[model samples]
Target chain A: MIRSGGLRLDGVTVLLADGSKFTRKLVAQMLAEFGVGTILEAEDGETALDALKRGPVDLLICDTLVENPDGITLTRMIRHDNGATYRSIPVLLLAGHTRQADVIRMRDCGASLILAKPVAPKALYDRLAWIARDPRPFVDSAIYAGPDRRHNVGEPPNGVARRQMDRERFADQTKSSVSHDEIMAILRQADSL
Target chain B: MRKSRFAALATRDGGRKRSDAVQAAESQLATMEGDYIAEADRLIAQLNVLSGAAQPDVEAIYRVAATLRGLGGAFGYVLVSDIAGSLCDLAERLGAAGQVDPPALLAHAQSLSLLHHRRVKGTGGDGEAQLCEGLARLVARWPAATLP
Candidate 1:
């Protein structure tokens, strides 16, 4: 967690879990320019765990293929820890691939954000700025503030029917919850073919 | 037993299965090699701009050299890895001392630059090859973590 100080800019401590010395240095330099005072480096997961034990870290920036304990497993450990200090810290996972499966896996591992590696300095700075802002509560309305507003529609005046009709027009909405007997009958019909 | 069952499954393999396994290994190796070449080329280009005495960022130089040393061999560029390792060692020594002889460092940087140029042109000499070999030998003596 970041300690509150008199400085207008927040004091951020970053833990970098990357095997690439070049990338670590570049990130350290960039964060320094962004007013981050404390930057910890770990070339592998084992060292990263050691660093975590040394002090309270505000943010963790980890590479996907860290030596020994990989980034996903590290994130799981952080998320599952009973300690308040460890659980509250945000994790940002970095990887070379932008594959959707990789992003999904990182998210499932409790990563707050996923960044593709070879990141530009400006983009990195922007992400840091976002992380510096006060984190929203998990159950906050902000989580569902997306384009999928139809899910929120309720009965009558809320236009639930209209939304349901629109959804049904595009695809079968009730097929997933059909009764087991109905599904069996359908399977039987298919078997006859 | 489970072990006996597993042995029975293993016995089902044929020549086609063996060839498929070999092909998979070859493909994986090729993909890793391609990724290595791309990353090395990018790092080499970045090194060209930063390798000079006038620059005061010792940590950055050490970091780049260290990464090259760690990754070059994995990517099949042992020569580049070896030279980078030597540079990292010198950079670390300079960093610890908090001061460096700029002229000497610049000369070393020049040599590295020349090697990079020769590698690019595919005309590296026996001396360059020997320098790379010497660097590799030096790197073998240092720990991976402290070098970067």
Candidate 2:
């Protein structure tokens, strides 16, 4: 997914959090091939947190089953770590096809993206592009904290149209009035880019 | 229309360079099959150990199946991953149920056994769909209520 604006990950530092030696080695090897500068491997969540505290990491490639604390727990802890230098690092969770309940849980736990495993470098690269381009602001709520889940419209395209009255009512209830400054700020950001 | 010979040569060289990179990356990945076999064999042995137990560790079985799910697709074994994926679903359901149905569990295990045992190609060759169809039936059998 090569886009207009360059999304070069050439010099970024990455952390690989997986328990299996083979999984960690393969992921690191692939990321190196992608031109990442520094790749660190952690076998558990505790090690991951320690690494984050010790260095400036741009991204986290985490496995769900990492022990001493799993990936979800690490994500939650990273999100909760206020004023810490490593709190804002983007986390990419590596997991299998998640059950519906776990999907919501992972989202709530602050995963920037979920890459379904057998990790294709092309898919991985596409995700990196998405993260670089899609500037989804963080959402802090009582129940969830991380990337905004509402970034996408929660409807499939070409689906049956809802009633006009229902649409109007829904829009009336959920719309937030934006300030002029807020709109201008967004416009300025786009212009600068 | 005249194409400059210099431009033509540059295009040829560029395409060759790009394809060469692709091939290098692919071959680098291809080198992991030995690792895959070793790790998979270890996991299968773990699964076999659990299967022999009067009451298998559902969480452990689920972990092995799930881990297999993650690894297969990365290494170009889509069919193997899909089979492992179905096994993961079954494992998760059985874990939630708090009781092991050994026969059903064994069925999923055997499906996985078929994957690694037979060395199904990563891109899904040699009866992969037929194999998956059999397991897909098993995956769909358990109702949604089985989820935790």
Candidate 3:
């Protein structure tokens, strides 16, 4: 029975990975304010992986440009190479630039959500809320393994559009506004097919 | 994926209001403004030093500029973010070619210095906007496809 006073994150353990110390501190502070119980800090991808292996992490908030394997690579590794528990956790990738190319890479790598850098509290809150209620299924395939990319909140076109007419028909429904139940139903039907 | 364990915990009843939580988080950012300014200053200085180097590390400049872009916008220094974003574009293009254009590096470094020195914030005036536009134009000269 979920009663809503606000978003309760007091029990969530977030792994905050970023190369820049300042960036990490800023985000960590926000997470603390949100009442996140345990916030783990990692400077790079390997350290982040180590943190994941050491114990349970509820969510992963990572920077796209974090050094070594980088955020995209790290997410890919989690989806493809890590254990089942590590593979399916929600991953929020923070990027400095949301350029088309960057968005493509982030999407292809299996991030649960992608946020632009200098993250605002409201945006962060909304994204976290969505993640909290996220109903997207874990997709395991040869080429891609993570949350079903076809169903995402802030997704970018990954060159998989269904030509001109289909796009025009659904142009009115913004991608981000798609409801969680709607996406789950769609994914369910997709799985059936 | 199944409902994340985070969801189960987060969606539990009893939590602070969203507005209150956001206000608290923003207040924390406000308190960090001074530190942000100091860090931005240090990064700008580092950029200037890199620009003066006989062979400026284009990758380093890109990384620094990327940092400035990320920081400045949060603190309402929109001009700093915009200019630094341009610098990142230029540096990335140049770095791919293994070329070091000191003048281009210095131009961005000087622009960042001017903004920081005058304490310009939030896109400044039309002049600042034009300056940013020019920098963006300089960046566009080297298209991503051309470099890649």
lDDT of each: 0.50, 0.64, 0.76
Task: Please write out the lDDT profile of model 3 over residues B43-111, one tens digit for every residue.
Answer: 999999997799888878888888788887676666677788888888877865667767667767877
lDDT by residue for model 2 over A57-111, one digit each (tens)? 8788899888889898899999888887777667889886576547657867988
Best by TM-score: 3
After superposition, which runs of candidate 3 have C-alpha atoms over 4 Å from their true positions? A82-84, A98-103, A152-193, B146-148
- For residues A84-186, could you state the per-residue lDDT of candidate 3 as single tens digits? 5677888999877544346567768988888766566766776787777777888888988888867755543222232222223323422232234533332
Q: What DockQ class does candidate 2 belong to?
A: incorrect
Any residue pairs clashing in model 1, and if so which? none
Candidate 2 lDDT, B1-148, residue by residue in tens? 2222211222221121223333455567778878988888887777767755788887787778777777765655555577667767767766665666555556556556655765655434334444455556655556543222
Ranking by DockQ: 3, 2, 1
Minimal lDDT window, size 10, model 3 chain B: B139-148
> Which predicted model would earn the best lDDT?
3
Model 1 interface CAPRI class: incorrect
Residue A80 alpha-carbon offset, candidate 2, angstroms:
1.4
